[model samples]
Every structure is written in C-alpha cells, then in structure tokens.
Target: MEFGILSLIPPIIMLVLVLLTRQVLLSLGAGIVVGAFMLNSFDIVPSFNEIWKSFSQIFYVEGDLQLGSIQLLSFLILLGITTAFMTASGGSSAFGEWAIQRIRTRKGAQTMPGILGLIIFIDDYFNSLAVGQVARPLTDRYKVSRAKLAYIIDSTSAPITVVSPISSWGAYIIGLIGTIIAAQEITGYGELEAFLRMIPMNFYVFGSIFLVFLTIYRKFDIGAMRKHEEKAQNTGELVDPSKEVPGDLNNEFKATQGGKIYHLIIPILVLIVATVTTMFITGIQGTPAEEEVSILSIFANTNVNRSLFFGGLFAALSGLVLYMFLQGSKSSTGKVVLEGIKAMLPAIYILVLAWMIGTIIGSMGTGEYLADRVKEANISPTFLPFMMFIVAGFMAFATGTSWGTFGIMLPIAGEIAATLDVAMFLPSLAAVLAGSVFGDHCSPISDTTILSSTGAGSNHIDHVMTQLPYALIGALAASVGYVIFGFTTSTILSLVVTLVIVLVVVLLFQPKQNSIEK
Candidate 1:
C-alpha cells in the first residue's frame, strides 16, 4: 500500500506536462489518471473506477448532490456573473476613467491591489476574486502586465491570511495546534498564544510580502516577469496575445453610457460585508450554547463555503438590480447574465480539474509518503527545522496544497520535536507553515495561484513562470533564517536577517531595466 518514492511520479509528471504543453486541463487530467493507476496497482478497471469515484464523490453523496461542492461552484458562477454585470453596466469602465485622473503613475496603479489584498484578509478566495474586480481596471489602464498583477494578488493573499489570526487559515491552524498540543499533553501556551508566537517566526511570509512591495515601489522584475512587464509597457497589452486568459471578456459586452463610480463600488462592498456577516453568523450558530462566543470562536467555527455562496448570490443580485435600474432594459437581462457566466467558465473548468487532481494526489499518498521519509530522517535536531522547511516545500510543490501539507507535516514535526528537543517545536512547525506558503506560492496547480490568474486575467502558466524566481529568492532567504533559528532561537534576529537579505537582493541586483519610466 505504501508506494513510497513511486508516490511522487504523478504530480511530477503533471508539472512537467503543464510546463511543456501549457495545457492545464489536460495536465490535471493526466495526473488524475496516473495517480489512479498507482492507487489501483495498474488494474485497468479498478483504475477507471478510481477516477470515476474521485469525481463522483465531489457531486454525489448518498444519492444527493454534495452541498460543499455545490456551494463552491454556485459561488463561482455568481461571482462570474457579478463581474459581467459590472462590465455591462459600465461600472468598471467608469471607475477606470475616474481613476486615470487621480492615479498618474504605473506604480500608483499597481500599489492598490497589494493594499486591497492586505485589507481583504477574511478569505483568500474572496481576496483573489474581489481585489481583481477593484484593481484590474486601474492596473490595466497603466499597462501593468496581468502576470504582474497576479503575482501581487497572490503574494499577499495566502501570506497575509496565513499570518493573520482573524482570517480563516489562522482559525484552521489554531484549531490544529490546539488538537496537536492536547494530544501531545504538552501545554505551556494555548492555541492563540502559540499562533501569535509563530507569526513572527514565519520568515517567508514577510520576505514574500516585502518582495512584492519592493517590486512595485522600487521597480524590479526577475525571469520571465521582466518580459511580461516590458511587453505590457511597450505595447499596452496587459496579457500575452497568444495565451488564453480567463475572466477577460473583450468587446463581448458594451459598457452602458452614464456610468458612475458608485455603480462599481456598491456591489463589491455588499459582497464583502455580506460574506463577513455570514461568517460570523455561521460561526455563532455552530458554537455550543455553553461556550462563550469570542473572536477566535467565530472564525474557528465559521462555514467558509456557505459564506461564499451566499455572498456571491447577494453580490450578483445587487449587481443585476443596479444594472437594470441604470440600463432600464437596454440590454436583455438574460444576455448580461449569460455573458457573465460565460466569462467564468474557464475559471470553473480549471477549478474543477484542480480539485480533482488534488483529490487524486491525496489518494496516492504523495504528501504522506514524503512526510514519512522526512520523519525517518537521521539528522541533528539543530537542522530539523531546516529539513522540515525544505521537505514541506517540496511536498507542497508536488501535491499543490499547503493546507494538506499542514495536515500531514505539522503533527509529524510536532512529534519529532517533542521526541528530540521540545525547544525545536515552534521553530519546526513555523518552518512548515512558512515553507508551505512558499511552495504554494510557486506552484502552477495551486488554487490560489489559479484564482489569481483568473482574477488578473493572466495566462495561468505565465503567472506561475513569472512568480517562480521571486518565490525561490524568498525561500532561500527563509531557509537561511530557519538555519539561523536552529543555531540560535532568536526570532527577531532570524526574521530581521531574512528581510534584510530580501532588501539587499532587490536593491543590489536589478534585473535589466525595462523602458517604464520612474
């Protein structure tokens, strides 16, 4: 049952195919088949069942459609329609025209998405989708490549959420930490305190965030990102003409005349407010009567899938009503809705395949096998954190899921540290957290990366290719910090040094400058 090293082949094959073919759907499908074969020991009939059951489980449970997948898909369709409605009503165009007067520089335009990503930390999915709606027009007007916008959106979304205890990711991690500590019977600090302690120790989070701001304010791009930036600036093309970009509906719908900035602003505001309120409500409802309701309790218990669905519904309806109020039946109601749904099909297709591959990868035990090997590593306790960071990064890179990495590696790291040296516990776990983000940040199959591409209207592969060098730079700096942490358990020293490394690299090594003026 334990395939060991063989578990790695499917994801690796998938990654290779995606890079070469630039075909995500086919690559993901191939991964599913390969993993299925491995899971079934190459028995053809059983392998086919493996593939069918993996997909069937997503939509069917006990003869009824599964609520979780249904809710998520509904949200995507609604969000797509909401985006379409904004365009059809001319709200998007109006806001762009309005912003051109105030925002005079490219950096100024690019800065807004990062700032918005920081503000919208409630959920990464929301942040990825909403930030694009707000920032895309501005960034496009300034000729910032869609790939660049995606990197900015992605770098901030997970890194911010993973660190902020109020966000969904923090809530999940805190719950896991509490469970691990309780099971281990080692408790000097509670879950909240433990999470707070790890925040500063998360070196990659800060390194990646700094890189994003530095790239925007200081003007730098590495690897293929430079080509993307140069092309965008020189030709006014935000995306590669040859590559397919989702969520970009060009000339498919006309912008209504007499559009106002408020038209664009209100629907998104409603969505954010609605989603947050639902999270709180679901959190409260899920809590026990005896338990005292608190901030931590709210987020930990909140139903994220349900919240997104309701939020998307409310936002889409608001957009529709507003469009009708303005256009007064100028465009057929069905036509606008259809266009919006059409724009989001590419996103939905990519998402479903990504989910399937993730499921298949989980079954193949790719992450678990890697974790087991790392668990068996015969290394000094001082290097435990560094080894964990590297292994966790590779596992996530291969499997395309940081949350899965956390589930598999955190307890193992906790157990290892508990057995070897209790002092290494936080450092090891923090390294896993940081490394998971770094891997997820660089992965082509990562959901956050995919949504970022959809949101920014970039070719998915371009976003992955452009962001890899920056992610590696941050990972290298973070690895050094983990090594230093191992030798000396000084969070301040390690974190500051990691950030300084990023600063020096950016300030000293400028990739050949593009023609964009300061």
Candidate 2:
C-alpha cells in the first residue's frame, strides 16, 4: 500500500513522455495506465480493469468530482458554440474592422489579449478560450505569431485568477487557507486578510503581468519566442514551421452585410451579467443572511463550475438568438452552432485526457509524496519559504494542476509556518501561490496551457516551447524575491526587487531589432 517514491513515477513518466514525444494524449493515457498498474500492485489484469472503471467513473459517477468535470466540459462546449455564432453572425468580423481602425501596430495587437485576459478574472477557463476566439482575427491581421498570442492568453489566465479577490481561484485558495488555519489552531487569523497581505508577495504573477507589458512596450522578444515572432513578421506564418493549422479556422467567418458591433457586445455582456448573478444567487440559496452577508463569503461558497456552465450556456443561446434574427433561417442557425461545437471537440478531448491523468496521479498521491520529501528534508526556517516555492513548483509542474499542488502543499507549509516567526507566514503562503502558478504556466499538461493553445490555434508543443522561457525567467525572479522577503520581511522591498530583476533580465536578454510592423 505504501508506494513511497513509486508515487512519483507516473507524473515523472508523463513529463518525460510529453517532452520527448510531444504527444499529449498518448503520454497522458500511458501515464494513467502506469499509475493504475501501480495502484493494482502490479497485477496486469486488475490494472487494465481499473483503467476502464476509472474512465467510466470519471464520466458517469454521481459525485461532485464527476459533476465538476461535466460542468467544465459543458462550459467548453458552450464557449465553442458562442464563439462560432459570433463568427457566423459577423460579430467577430465587425469587431475586427473596428479594432483595425484603432489598433495600428504589433504592440497594440499583442496588448488586446493581455488586457482581455486580465479583465476576465472570473475564471481562467473563460479567459483562455474567449480571449483566443475574440483576438485571433486581430492578431492574424498584424501577423502576430500564434505562439505569441498563446503566450499572452496563457500568462494572463492563471496569474490573474490567482491574484483576483473574487474569482474561482481566490475562493479555492481561501478555502485551503481556512482549513490550514483551523488545523493549525492559529487563533484570530483572518483568511481574507492573510490573502490580501500576500498579494504583493505573489511575485511570479505580478512579475509575469509586468513582463507582458514590458516585452510589448519595448519591442522585446527573446529565445524561442523571438524566433517565432520574426518568422511571423518575415513570412507571415503565425504558427511554427512544422505545424499546419487550417486556414478555414481563420477565414471561415465571412462578415454579414450589415452586422453591427452590438451583435458581439450584447452576448458578452449577457454572459458576464448572468455569471455574476448566478454566483450571487447560488451563494445565497442555502445560507442564512447573517452568515453569508459579505460578498466575499458568498463568492467563496458558490459552486463556480455550475455557474460557469450556466453562464456559457446563456451566452451561447444569446449568440444563437442574435444569429437567428440576422440570418432569419433556422437551418443556418443550427448548422453554424454545430460547426462551433465541432471546432471545440479536439480541445474537449485533450481536456478529458488531462483530467483523467490528473485523477490517476491523485490516486497515486503524487503531490503528497513530493511534499513529504520536502517536509522530511532538514530545511531552516529562514530558507523554508524559498524552498517551499521550489517544491510547490515542481509538484505542480509534474501534476499539471496548481489546485492540486495547493491542496497538498499549503497544509504542510502552514504547519511549518506555525513554528516560525509570525512574519514568515505570509511569505511562505505567497511562495506556494506564486510557485504553483509558475509551474502551471510552464506545464505542457496543464489545462489552461492546453486551452491557450486551443484558443490561439497554435501547435500545443510549440506553445509550450515558446512560453517556457518567459515563465522560467519570472520563476527565477520570484525565487530570488522570496529569498529577499524571507530575510527582510518587507513586502514592498521584496516586490520592488522582484520587479527590478524581471525588468533587468528581460532587457538584458532582449533581441535588438527595429520596431515590429506588419
């Protein structure tokens, strides 16, 4: 029963296979099968049986986990439908025309996704898919690399969610911290307060956001990204050299004769309003007013997956209605909606495989095993925050889920923090949050990463390769920043140093070139 180091084997195998093979589904499926074998104590028959059972349970079981997965899948399906409808109705074309008149340069093209990513802080899933669908046309017009568009979408999603106070990520984090505080018997500690204090210390998220702007403003591109961008500029190929994305994806949405920008604006507004209202209503459905008075409390308790499903459905329906009126033909509406859902089938498949692998790893206890190694190691209190950051990053990178990393590492970090100076608590907490995002950002197996690739229509491997360098730089800067925070216990000083490190590193490594123009 005690797998010990064997618990880590599945994730390690998955990571190796991904890097070597660049085949995500095969790699994930193989990793899950290997983990199943381990779970069945190396009995080939039972392992094979277990794999099928797990797959069935993941899709059909009447449990929260199964429901959650279904909710996510539904959201993705609806997102695809909404996007397709927007294109079919000529909403995307209208927006493209409007944006073209305003956005006249490469930086402007790049900035739009980043801005949208930041604005859509309700959920990273929504941010990733929506940004890609909305911005792909604009980026293509300027010949921005699909890799770069992916980078922008990827950078903004997890980082912004982790930092925003009213997102699904924020709620999950608060719940994790609350449980830790309760177990530690730490009195008078406010989860929201502690989270607020750690915001400035979340170096990687802040650094990544800042790096996005700095890279854009200074016309800076380095490493694989620089090469990809140059290729896009010179040859107008926005994807990697070896990849072949269908031109229909970019050109299929012919503009309607008189489609207005309102066609796009109305549905998106409805989606946002419906989501927020649903969250509040869901939050208040069962709780007494006295207990759930605060908006934060309401948000923290709401079923985010369900809300997302409903929101996406509403948005898709709204889009359908708009298209019906525009086309005045039910068959045209039905065909376009089906096309949108079909477009997302590949992404949905990847998502299902990723979740299956995550489930298998969870059963193997990959994250806890990694945490145990870190906890058992003799680490000093002063250096614990920095060390925890690395440990959390590795665990997340291997498992491809920062949420899983948080569930495993935060309790351990909280227990350790209780024994250290009071000032050390926030830095340790921030380290875990920042490092988890870092790992998720760089991980090829991460759902958000896959969504980013799907959204930008980039080759998944190419997106991973190009974005990894930027993520690493931000990680390195955050690691150094945590060390400074550990020593000084000054959030402001630590934050300033981290920003300086990121800016300096970016400027130093930047490729010198004339300002980019399409």
Candidate 3:
C-alpha cells in the first residue's frame, strides 16, 4: 500500500471502530495498528522484522525516527512525572481545599477557575493541568458542572499561550514567523522583530484570551455548557467526582484555613517566575548576547531540561515542606503527593499512546504527502490562510495532536508563504498556529483534553462531548477572523467584529443550562 492511501486507511478504520463501539482507546489503538500494518505490508517476514526496528528507531536514539516524536515523548514523560510528584506532595489537593474555602457564591465558584486559568498563562500545558487540578474541587463545592470546568481549562490553554509573549508557544510561533519571512525573501525583518510587529495583527490570539475573561467575569454562557450549568443548579447534582470531597457540609467552613491558600499560591508563583527567568536567560528571542552566545549554545551548555526538571522538583518539594511545617503532620503531605501521582496515571498512559501513534504517523510520511497534495492544488494567495486554517484544523483533529499538527503544517505553511511573495507571511503563520489550537481545543484525542478531564475529575468523554459546542463557537469566531485578516483590507476591524459577534452569540444562547440537563 502506498503511504497516501495507507494514511487514509487508519483514520477511516478509526472512524468506523469509534462510531461502532464508542471506545476511544480501542479506536486509537486500532488506528496505530493499522498504521503499523500498512508500513509493514510490503513484506510479511521483513515487515515483522522491521516492527521492532521501527519501534526502536522511533523510541531510541538510533534509526530514522522523527525528532519531534522524541521531544514529545520526553516532554510528556517529564510532565507526567512532575504532575505525579506534585500531587504526591499534596500541593494539588491543598490548593483545591484552599480555593473552596473562599468560594461561597455560585458565581464566584464558576469564575475562579477562569481567573486561575488566565493567571497560569506561562505555559499551556501547565495552565491546563494545574488549573484543572486546583479548581475542580472548588467548582464542585459550589455545584459547578464538570463540563464547565473543562471548558474553562481548554479555552484558556491555547488562547492564553498564543497571546503570552514569554511562553514556549511564543518562542515557537516567533520562530515560525521568522521562517515565513525568510522564505518570502523579506529583508531587514528579524524573526522576533517580525513577530513583534505582527503582534497587533495577531487578533485571534489576543481576542480569544479576552473573550475567555469576559465569559468568566461577566458570567456569559453559551451553547451546551450553559445547559449543563442550569441543570446542575436545578438538580444540585455533582457532575464530577473530583468535586466531591470528604466531610460534612456544615463543617466545610471549619475545614478552611488561610495558610492552605498560601501553599497553592506560592508554588504557582515560583513556577511562573522560573519560566520567565529561564526564557530570558536563554534569550529565546535572540538576545544581544546572541552575537557571541547563541540560544542553542546556551541551552546545550546549561542542560536546560535538568534545570526545569529540578525547578518542578523543588516546587513540589517546597509545597510538601510547607504542608508539613504548617499542618504539623496532620496534613499527611507525603500521602497527598502519592495520591496526586496516582491520580495522573490514566492521563499519562493516554498521552504515551498518543505520542506513539503520532510517531507512527510521522514515520509513515503523511505530512509530506499532504503538503505535496496541497501544493499541487495551487490555492489562491488570498484564500491561502483561510484554507490553511481549515486544513490544519482537520489534520490536528484527525491526529488528536496539536504539536503534531504544527510539525506537519509549519514547514508547508512556511513554504507556501514564501511562494506568495511577502504579502501573505503574517497571515499564513497565524493561520497555522490558529488552526493547530482550534483542533487541540475541540479534539477528544488531544492531550490537553485528556489532562483537563483528569484535572477536573470528569469522565473524559463527558468533557469532550460538553466542551465541543463551546469550542466550535470559538472556532467559528476564529475562522471568520482568519478570513477577514487573510483576504480583506480591514484585518483589525474583522477581528473586532468577529469577537463581538461571538460574544453576543454566547451571551444570548447560554448553553450551559440546557446541555447539563441532557
């Protein structure tokens, strides 16, 4: 089987299996197996021989494995270990208990997660997992729906990351922007410099973040999420198990303490500070020192991962120390940390599988084939960005992985932008990032989606099902914004108009009330 037709086979098989059985893991596994079988179909004996070869090539240092696969696996494992360690130390639970003490009203309960999500914009991965973990209990305490919590977490993750100039996402986007400019033969425009110039024009990123804040602070509800919220309020049902903490209602206030809140706040603050400092020192945007000391050189010299690994390690350690010092052994800090790690096991497993599947897809040359087909289509320059956005969205959704989407889209988008003279550079780059985020936000297979559910203690399917409508609203808004920016003279106006329309729709429809009941 040629790779092109073989590529279609996995998704088709996955779709049929998923629809017939509704088992996500089984579907994903079948897709992986199909991809592997396709790769080995040329020769049974040689293919079986190559299976171990392929696996080792992808997993180990040798072979023709994709570097992105290795980076993703390393990051996921580190993330899992860090998350497990943090929870094991009791920091996550302590934060939740602390937040619950202050959230008395229903509105406050609902808004708190949004606020936390906004503040944790240092990294999307951090923001998605940490906010979900800390806010779930508080949201549950006030009878807030699990779907709502997942929505807040997912909405905040990619949107905030896109806007934050200091994040890992920022660095990646800036690099892509540079590639677009260079490919287009644009002179005198540095990568970071070009990105900064386009910041004002990156309306979707900023607008999405602003819309999230509005949704929370203004109590705006839309689509299915509104329906869920209303049902929870009417029935007083706990939609999420993580929301159910042990102990009686009358004694809830008595269980609260001022010091518990500080434990949560301080560690988060440390992580943020560390992230910023690391980026700055590394000169992610090419510091003046880059003339003599390259960012890559600095990273290689300092063993940066070790620093982040230890930084997270110390943050967990400090949280435990505080727990013991303040609670005087009543806190069971060690037990708390242990439980947190145990809690994250399921998410970790899912992420590992996702990475493996992504690796197989990459190894099979899917991205190159897709890019070649796209190039042959000869799309118009004016429609390029909009089309790219749609294509990227579909690819990410199909793969259930945004980073993988970027890995495939960035090079193609850069090449396309280059071919279109210089006029389409910024718009093209924006489309790729926006599309990747759109799929990640909506896809049930995404790591962020799984993590959000894990953090909220909600069923993964329920989170995916409930969050889809709201995500689509944002995607529609973004799509319109992309079209206007891509093809028209009034890019900023298009963005503003699109955002305003989406906000109005959300406020008016208010889906939380209706969706939750179903």
Clash counts for the predictions, in order: 0, 0, 21
Worst 10 residues of 1 by lDDT: 509-518
- Which residue segments of model 1 deviate by more than 4 Å? 328-330
- How do the residues 1-518 of candidate 3 rate in per-residue lDDT, one tens digit apiece? 45774676676676577557656667777777777777877566665554455456555654455554454444334344444433433444566666667765666876777778877765666677567656765776667777777777877777777655556666666656666566667777787776666565555555556666676665565555565667677776546343321111211112224354456666655655664466456553344443456543332233233334444555555555665575433334444554544444555555656655666666676655666777778788877778777787777776777767776787787677777745776677667777777777766567777767765656566667676666676677777777777667466786786688677876776434333222
Candidate 2 error regions (>4 Å): 62-65, 187-189, 240-255, 286-290, 327-331, 514-518
lDDT of 1 by residue, 101-144 (tens): 99998889999999999999988888898899899888988889
Error of 2 at 152 (Å): 1.2
- Give the Cα RMSD of candidate 3: 5.4
- Positional deviation of residue 243's Cα in model 2 after best superposition, in angstroms: 4.6
Q: Please provide, for model 2 over 1-518, each residue's C-alpha lDDT reduced to its tens digit, 9 standing for 90 to 100.
A: 77888888888887788789977777788888999999998899999887887777767766445787788888877877887777777777788788889999878999999999999897787788777877887888888889899899999999999988788789779878878778877776688887887788898999999988887777667777888888899888887555533112444445565677777877777777787788888876734666845666776777777877888899999988888788533236677777777777767777777777787888887787888888788777788789888998988888899888888888888888887655577678888998899999878779889888888878777788888988998988888888887788778888899899999987787677755553
**Winner of 2 and 3 under TM-score:** 2
- Candidate 1 lDDT at 357 equals 82
Provide TM-scores for the models: 0.97, 0.93, 0.79
Candidate 1 RMSD to the correct structure: 1.4
lDDT, candidates in the order shown: 0.88, 0.81, 0.62
The predicted structure with the larger lDDT, 1 or 2, is 1
